[model samples]
Target chain A: MLVIARHTLRETVRKRLLLAVVVLTALFLLLYGVGSELLARQIRERMLTNVDTALPLAASMLTLMGFYITSFLGALLAIFVSMGSVAAELETGTILTLAARPIRRWEIVLGKWLGLATLIAVYLIVASLGILALTRWATQYTPPSPVPATALLILEALVILSLGMLGSALFSTLTSGAVVFMLHATGWIGGLVEALGSVFDSQAMVTAGILSSMLVPSDALWKGASFYLQPVTVILAQNASPLANPFVSATPIATSMLLYSGLYLVACLLLTVRRFAHQDL
Target chain B: MTVAIETVDLCKQYGRRLAVDRVSLQVESGEVFGFLGANGAGKTTFVKMLLGLVHPTSGVAHLLGRPIQDPRSRLPVGYQPEQFRLPEWMTGTETLELYGQLSGASRQDLRVEIPRALERVGLGGRGNEGVRAYSKGMQQRLALAQALIARPKLVLLDEPTSALDPVGRRDIRDLIRALRDERVTVFLNSHLLAEVELVCDRVAILHEGSVVREGRLQDLLKTSTQLRVVVDAVTPAVVEAVRPFAHAVVPNGRSLDIELLSPDHVPAVTRALHDAGAQIWEVRPQQMSLEDVFIGIVRPRENG
Candidate 1:
């Protein structure tokens, strides 16, 4: 099993797609750091003109910028890392040789998930560190704490990766990636829709938005991460409750999604094993 | 002698088509059993079923006297599939070592045997080279080496010589024959009649998912009493004179083609042809080649 896992990790890590992700992430980080450094230097210089006004607002905006940047990059990495887990193997018949071996099907699935999770973990650490490093270097700004934010980002990535892998099992690679992307996109859309409905007092629209969030809770998790990472005073002043509006706040993902992911992995593995066990060579 | 592999009423179906009908066969230890058939004749399907690469619809297969599905049974069988696809980026050595390890070869054992296995298959120092760089024949040799390296009790080869050149064919045949000397059962499928006729101790001809004829090579070719005689001259008198000893003797200007009743009549027919002022050039008994037998039996059934 370790042999299988090691080989899978090595083979996938060598993929040009993953390499491209690494290159893009590195370039983005360099740009973000350099750009933010310039912006902060200008803000600091402007602070000499208006000492009280510029600094605090700039610090707050900097924190928000870090959150937005990290969240988007995390989501992209999670989706890209797992989109091809099953579908690519099925397409290339690479899985056939391994599945035909004495190893159980679920072991193959678990190994793949573990390998992808490790990849996601690496990207999360690098990107979060990039954000933290940029903020410190640019503005002498250090947010209260980044550990919670980084943890939340990692959790979000894990959830997305699991969903993407499940989608891969059910649909072709392209379809699965598209579905995961759409779910992530619409989950954010639903949050916006719910905010509009509440402000305008549209009961029917509010309910519709809430139901959409329940259907795919990716945005709910992201919103929860937002709550976890934000200073407590901000939430109290805004009267924002993660649970009061499931569409906008990241509530703890239901126990069912976790259970569903476990089941999904097992089912995908069994289907692969049974189908490939007797596959005509 | 113990049978290395045995199948009882093995049957397989794909949708409405019976790919391999009820077939039973036994390949004993130290015998090279040729599975002869045209394309689509269940040779591949049968080999798959035997190797546990595919499930038989209804049958029992025993490898090394244990049930085929039993984990223990599979340990003693090494298989090289007909249309095998290996990882393109893997070096030939890596591919062999991986499979060798999977087949339960110890690292210590692999160290001593890996290079020799490569050399035997003509990929000796090329193990580190990626499979994509290898030609079709070289890839095939590497595949064969992987199959044989484990030195399993039985090697299930499908179309083992199909794409090989004459030299490669001879090498493979020799390797297969060598396996028998090691007391390994060689169960191979091939369309090459001469290959089977030369190396097989016994062969079964499959047609339309059924075994049409099967026996030892000597037994399959043993039944012939016809004598073909070539002479310097052939005339009506020579045909008429030889007619008494042959079922029919037609004069073809230079030779008298005689289909005789028995081998005893060959000498008399030759003497009669010679006595009729015909100079005898050559006289020999007609023996059936595998091709002749295959065409003779399969064509009529196909036509009908």
Candidate 2:
């Protein structure tokens, strides 16, 4: 299993996709830092009516954007990287050699999962945290919850990767990506629905959002992260505001959803293994 | 003698289509066994079932004296899939190293065996070159090297010479013979009748997901009853003159295939062609080749 995992990581790193992702990420991070620095200078020079609200809100907004960018790109990366994990081997006939070996099919699944999981972990720590560090260097303020919020973002990306693995087992690589993207999109749209529900104080709308989250808890995880990143005082003040807020969850994610998300990831991985184990090459 | 492969009513199906129907056969240890079949004849599926890449729907198969259900049964087996692809970015050496690791080769075994394995397949000094730079035949050889690197007791090769040039084909044939000489059991699955006829001691012809014929090469060829007669000019009159003695005559260009009622018709056939003043280039008793036997079996099923 370690052998397969090591080789998987080596092959993945050699992909042109990773090179492009890394370069684009670095460039985006640089530009964002520069933009933040300019905003910090302007904020300091200008007179602010309420520094408390202004300072944390500015920092939280930047941190929130950073989280969104990293999470979105990380999801794309996971889908693209893992979509071909099993299907491509089955398609190109390369899996024949490995499948003929004395290794179990589940071992192949576990090895590939571990390899991609490790890659996603590194990507999150570097790309997501790098953005946070850049925002901090430019502005003295930071989000209230940095570590846990990033952890939530990482879990969200993993959920996508696990789903991608299941799709790879169930469909072609292109179809898997397309299908997993739909699942990811459903989560995003569900988050919006929940955010609207929170703003409108509608139980039915929140119920709809909860239904979608049960199917894929990616939105729930993001909401949990947002609960940490958003300013409490601002959210409290916005409660009486008339306009709609995208999403401002005052409470963290339900412990049940978190537990279910963990199970969803495991279920995807297990289903992939079970499906491929008895499948014809 | 020990049995290298054994199958009893082994079957595989894809939806409504039966890819490998209930088929059973036994191959003795250290024998070069050819599995002859046309495209979609379930030859590949049978091999996969033997290797455990495809689960058998029913019946049983044993490899290296162990049931195919056990993963360890495949540990000492080597397989090269038809038209396999190596990671294009990996150098040949890296490819071998990776396969070695996956196959559970120790570091010491790899250090000593990889260079020698590369040389065995005629890619001795080219291991550093990336697979992207290698030609199709070279890549095929690399796949073969990977299969043989571990020196297994059994090797299953699927269309081992399909993409090779004439010289390359000869090299692979020689390699197969060498494996035979080394007492390695070979399950050679191929549609290349000529190549199989050259190397295999025994063969099985499969069609429509069933093993239609299986036996020693010479024995199967001997079962063909049609006699071939080559003449310089098989004109209409020459065909007419021999039609009386021949049960069925199929004249194509300079060759005439005559179905014989009895072996005694050879003299009458020659006399009839001579009476018509046709020059007979060759009139010896025609023996069945592998191709003739294969078509004889597959033609009926294909027509049905």
Candidate 3:
């Protein structure tokens, strides 16, 4: 299993997708960070009056942008990296040589998942730290605790990788990628429904949205990250602040969702191993 | 004559199609057994079932006296599948090491065997080259090297030399033969009649998923009935004299072509030919080549 993991990690590191994701995310942070800082400076000078909320507002706003961008890009990277873990190996016939050996199929699946998870964790840690450095250097603003948010972001990336790996096991790459993308998109949109339900006293809509979040749990994790990154002042803001919108705050994920994701991945791994074991090459 | 591998009414199905139809075979230890069939004749499907890659529809297979259902049974078995694909990103050395570990080769064993195994496959110093850079033959050699890494007691090779050059083929054949000296059983699946004829002690020919014919190579070929008669003078009396022993006779100055019912009939025909005034030069028997037997069994298309 170690050998398999070692080889898999080597191959994955050689893939351009990892470097591409890092470069794109850094470019995004640079542009978004510089532009937002310049705009905040302009507003402060134009008013000819110092606003207490200016720095906090800009810091929260910039963190929110970084969070959103990382969440979306992290999910994208996870999906792209993991979508072909099983199906591509089977299709390309590489698994034939491996399967013909005495190694078990479950070991292979788990090994691949481990390698991909490691890659995702490294990306999240490095990129999140880079974003934090940018926030400090450019705006001289720091959120309450960046470490917790980074940890949550790592978990989020893992969940997404699990989803994509599950899809890869159940279907071909094309179909798997499409289905996972839809699940992600729906999860994001459902976050809105859950938020609106609390404002309008719509229990049915809230139930539907909560159920959707339970189905994927990705949106719930993002909302949790938002709550962590946003300040208490913005949470109570009346003008529907972008950083801590009340609608986004309403649906805090239940503990059960994390268990579901874990169980979901375990089930996916079991099914994949079973299917792959008997699969004729 | 202990059987190293055995299948008891082994069957496999792909959806509605019967890929392997109630096949049973026994391969003795220290023997090279050839599995012959046309394309899509269930050769590969049967091999897959034996390797437990594909679950059998019904029945069971035993490798090295243990049921294939037992994962441990694979430890003593080695396989080179026809459609074998190596991971392109892996170097040849890394690939062999992986299989060696999976096969439970000891560090001491690997230290001595890895390099020698590569050399046996003509991949001596190219171990660091990625599989993608290797030619088809090199990839096949690497596959063969991996399959034989552990000195498995039984080796199942499917077209083991398909992509190899003549020298490479000879090297593999020699390696296979060497395995036999160590009491290893070799189950070879190939359409290469010449290779099978040269190596296989016993062979089973499959046609449309069923074993149509099987036996020792010599016994199968010996079953083909033909007469070879050499006479100093080929005359009408000699032909007429030999007429009762044959279905038809064609006189060719020094040779008399005779139809034979069985190989045993040759002695009687020779006696009858000697009874006549003609001088009998020599009496011989005709044996079918593996190619002849192959073509005879696999019914060719009308146009073909």
Candidate 4:
């Protein structure tokens, strides 16, 4: 299993797509690096030299914006990397030799899943932490709860990875990736509907949104992360700002939502194992 | 004699498609067993079923005394799948190393075997080249080498020579023969009848997912008992005289092709032709080609 996991990691990490993504990510970080330096210099000058200037919530808004961009990219990268993990092997008949070896089918699934999961974890930690640290460096302000918010964001990416792998079991690699992305987009739409339903106090509208979230908990995880990243005062400001609506939630995600995310992960993983075990190559 | 591979009423289905019907077969230890079939005849499906790549819809397969699904059962088994694909990023040596790890070979064991396996398949010193750089025939050789990496007791090769040149095909045939000499049971699945004829000790012909014929190659082809004779200065009298002793006679380019009732009739036919003032040039029993036997078994029943 370790051999398979290591080999799987080697296979995915060596792809040109990952290299392109890494290059893009580096460019993104460089731009942020320069922006953060300028913002930090500006904050120091304003806070020390100038007084009586009403400090706008630039840090808070940037925090939300940074996390949103990084998190969305992270989620998409996770899906892109994992979309063909097993499906490509099955399609190209590359899995035959491995499947015929002394290893069991479930080991292949679990090993591959472990490699992708570990990849997403490392990526989430480095990119998310780097983004947050840069934000803090720029504005000298942090989120209300950094650790929980980061954990939820990581979970959101993992949820997408899990669904991508699950889709790979039933469809071709590209189709599975597309399906996971569609489901993710649907969840975002659902989260928006639920947020609107809350403001209007419409149970029917809320139920419709909640049903989609139940199918895939990507939006729930994001909403949960947003709840921790923004304080109540910032939420009030966000409610008034139409531009900030995508990243803002009226209330913290319910604790039950976390349970659903956990269950969704296990369910997708288990189904992948069972389906791949019997699937023809 | 121990059975290295045995299947009892094995079947595989794809929706309404009966890919592999209730096919039963047994291959004894050290036998080079050939599996022949037409397109979509379920040869690959059966092989996959035995290797646990495809779940059996019913029945059972045993390899080296354990059920097919049991991983331990595959410890002594090596497989070269049809249209084999290896990770293109890996060198041939790395590919072997990976399979070595999967086969649970110790470092010492791999150390002793890797170079020898590569050399055996005629890919010596080219192990460092990435598979993406290998030509199709070279890649095929490397696939065979990986199957030999663990020194398995049974090697299942599907279309092992499908991508090879004439020399490469001969190399694979010689390799199969060498495996047979080493007492390794080989399940050779191929549509290449000539190759099968050269190496197989036993064969099973599959038609429409069923084993239409199974027996020792010699026994299955024994009934082809035809003697071809070449004669010089032969006339209609020589042909007519030879016809009495031969069950059937065909004349082409100064040679009379005689279908002998048995081996005993060969001497008599030669004597009759010689007595007719025909100078006998050459005479030999016509061994049935694997292609003929295969066509006989796999062609539609109405044609037969």
Candidate 5:
């Protein structure tokens, strides 16, 4: 398993995927720093009576947007990297030699998952921290719970990674990519429905949203992270408003939902291994 | 001698069609065993079952005395697939190192063995080149190198030389001989009958998911029922006299190619020819090539 993991890492690097990711990440950070600096400058020039409250609100909102985009980048990386893990190898016949080795089939799936998991973890840490640091540098403000927020963001990416890997084992590369993307879109739409439910006070809409989150908990994880990253004032304000908005979570994800997401990740990994073990190559 | 591979009534069914039908075979250690079959004849399916790449629908198979389901069974086995696909981004040495480690070779052993394996396959100093840059023949050599790097007890090569030129095929033939000399069991599957005839000690010919023929190489090719007889005269009476002894007789310039119904009729045909007053110069039995035997076995079944 270690050998396979090492080989996977090496292959990813040699294919230049990692290099492309690094360049794109650097460009994103540059743009983010410039944007945050300009926003901070505009707020400073306004000279409002409640500048003290207005400044922190503006900074937290900007930081939340940065974290949002970081999470999006992380999720895209996770999906594209893992979507071809098994299906591409099988398609190209490269899996024949690897599968014929003495290692068990589960080890192959887990080794690839570990390698990609490491890559995603590192990217999330760097990108999330970079956003937090840049926002603080420009606005002199920080979120109340940055550590838990970043951890939640990483978990969200991992959940998507597991789903992509499972799809790779079960379908062709193109089909796997399409299926995982659709599931991800479903999670995002469900989050929107839940927010609208709160605005309209509709229990039925809220229940449907919760069920969809149960199916794919990517949006739930993001909401959990958003709860950590938001200021107390913003949370109170969002709760007081009757308008629907997808970005702010008035409440944290339930403890049960977080546990379910963990279980969901494990289930996806186990299913991938089982399907690959029984599949004919 | 110990049995390297043993399968008893093993089968594989893809949906309604039975791709492999109750194939039972035993190949001994240190023997070069040839698996012959036409396309879709279940040759690749059988090999995959032995390697545990495909699960058997029923019955059982064992490799090197361990059940195929046991991962340990493949610890001493090496395989070069017919498709011969390698990770294009990896160098030759990296590919060998990866496979060697998966086969449980120590890092120290691979450091020494990788170079030697590459040299054996004629890759030598070119080990650092990526596989994407390699030609078909070079890629084949790299695939063969990885298979042998661990010094496995059994090597399964499917169409081991399909992409090679004549010289490369000869080199592979020589390599097989060298492996046989080292007491490694080689289960070779190839459409090149001539190469099999040159290197295999025993063979099993599969037809429609069944072993139609299996025996020692010499026994399978030795003295078919066709006999060639040279006569001094081209007499009508001589041909007429031997017609009853043979199923068909084609008269050449000075010889008669007679297809006998059985080997028991050899002496009777000689006597009849002598009684017709034709002087016989030479009489010999015909030896069938592997192609002749394969066509004869597969074509008839196909037509029927």
Candidate 6:
């Protein structure tokens, strides 16, 4: 299993896609740093009333925005990297010799999952920290619980990664990518609807959103991370506003929902292993 | 002799189509066994079943001594698939190392064996080159190198020489012979009948998902031998006299094509022609090629 993991890591690192990812990540950090510095200066010059409250709220929103984009990038990387992990090998016939070896079929699935999971973890850590450090430097504001926030962010990416692998095992590469991407989009839309429902105090809309989140808990995970990353003052400001926003949560994510997301990740991985083991290659 | 491979009523059905049907065969240790079939005749499916790549519908197969379902059954086995597909991003050495590791070879041992395997397959100095940069033949050589890197007790090669030039084919033939000399079992699946005829000790011909024929190479080919005789005169008396010794005789130009019961009947037919007062110009023996045997078995069933 470790051998397969090493091989998978080496192969993914050597791809030209990784080079593109590195360049784009650098460009994104530079842009965010410049944009935050300008925003911080504007807030100081223009906002004279409630300066303490407005400044921290603005900085927290900027940090949340950075993390939001980071989460998006991380989810895309996870899906794209894992969507072809098994299906492409099957299509190209490379799995024949590998499957015939003495290793168990579950090891192949687990090894690949481990490799991609490690990549996603590293990306999340670096991108999240980069955003946090830049926000701290520019605005002198830091979230109360960065560790749990980052952990939740990492969990969201892992949830997507495991789903992508399951899709890879069950469908063709194109179909798997489409299905997983749609599931993620559904999860994001569900989060938006739930936030809107909360603002209007509509139970039906909230229930509908909850159902979609049940289908794919990625958005719920992000909401949990959002709750952790927001300062109390920012949460109050967002709650007072009449409009719904994705950057701040009025309530923390339920512990039960967090437990469900962990189980969902495991179920996807287990299903992937089972399906691949029985498939004819 | 120990049996290297055995199957009993092995079968694989893809929906309504029976890709393999009741294929029961035994391959003895240290022998070169050939598996022949036309397209869609289920040769690859059968091989996959033996390697646990394809699930059998209803049958049992054993590699070495363990059941096919057991992963350990493949520990001492090596396989070169007909597709010859390897990860393009990997170097040849890396490819072998991955496979060697999967086969349970220690990293320390692979550090020595990988280079030796590459050298054996004519890729000694080219091990560092990525497989994407390799030509088709080079990739084939690399594939074979990976299969042999662990020095498996049984090697399953499907069309092992399909992508090779004449020189490459000769080199592979030599390598197969070397493996045989090392007392290794080789189950070769190939369409190159001539190559199979040269290297295989025994063979099984699969036709329409069934084992239509199986035997020692000499035993299968010996039954189709014919004697060709040239006589000075085409007379009814000579034909009538040799009729007792030949199974069937057909006149072709100035020669009589006679199928005798055995090579021992050759001298008897010659004496009979002499006794009929006919001058014997020349006598030659013709042995059937493996191609003839394959076509003869598959074509008739196909037509009927």
**Model number with the top TM-score:** 5
* lDDT, candidate 6, A78-157, per-residue tens: 88998899999999999999999988899999999998888889888998888888888888889888889889989999
Off by over 4 Å in 5: B234-237, B275-277
Q: On lDDT, who's better, 3 or 5?
A: 5
* Best-performing candidate as measured by lDDT: 5
Q: Give a tens-digit lDDT track for model 3, residues A1-281.
A: 77677667777766566667767877988887787678667766775655556866777778777877887788888888778888788777777767766777777878888888888888888777877777777677777767777776777778878888888887888788888889988877787887777667789878988888877777777777766676767666723543435434523345676677667656766777777666766
Q: After best superposition, candidate 1 residue A261: deviation in angstroms?
A: 4.5
Candidate 4 lDDT score at position B108: 88
lDDT per residue, candidate 4, A1-281, as tens digits?
Answer: 88888888777766666678778887887788678667666776778744222122566666777777777887898889878888888777779888889889889888888887787777777877777777777666677887887888888888888788889998999999999999998888888887788767779979989998997788888877877777667788777764446546756778788888988888888998989887877
User: Please, what are the lDDT tens digits per residue for candidate 3 over residues B16-103?
Assistant: 9999999999888888999999889999989988877888999978988788877678898888978778888778887888788878
* Candidate 6 chain B minimal-lDDT segment of 10 residues: B219-228
Tens digit of lDDT per residue, candidate 2, span B35-154? 999999999999999999989889899998899989888888889998678788888998888888777888889888889889988899999999999999999999998888777889
Which 10 consecutive positions of candidate 1 chain A have the poorest summed lDDT? A242-251
Model 6, B64-127: lDDT tens digits are: 9899999999999999999999999989999999999999999899999999999999999999
What is the TM-score (0 to 1) of candidate 3? 0.89
Which pairs clash (backbone N, Cα, C closer than 3 Å) in model 2? none
Top candidate on DockQ is 5
- Candidate 1 collision pairs: A223-A250, A224-A250
Q: Is candidate 1 or candidate 4 better by DockQ?
A: 4
What are the interface RMSDs of all the models? 3.4, 1.1, 1.8, 1.1, 0.5, 0.7
lDDT, residue A264, model 5: 100
**Per-residue accuracy of model 1 over A161-184 as CA lDDT, tens digit each:** 777777777678889899989987
Ranking by lDDT: 5, 6, 2, 4, 3, 1
Residue pairs whose backbone atoms clash in candidate 4: none
lDDT of 5 by residue, A8-58 (tens): 887778889989998999899989899989988888888667668878898
Q: For every candidate, how close is chain A to the native chain A in TM-score? A: 0.80, 0.93, 0.90, 0.89, 0.96, 0.95
lDDT of 4 by residue, B1-304 (tens): 8999999999998899999999999999999999998777899999988888888999999998999989888899999998789888889998999898898887789887999999999999999999999999999999998899999999999999888999999998899999999999999998888888889999998888999899999988876657888888668998899776667888888887887766677778878888888898999888888787777555656376
lDDT of 5: 0.91
Compose the digit string of candidate 1's lDDT tens values, residues B90-187.
78877777667666778788887789889877788998998889888887887788777766788878887667899999999888878888888888
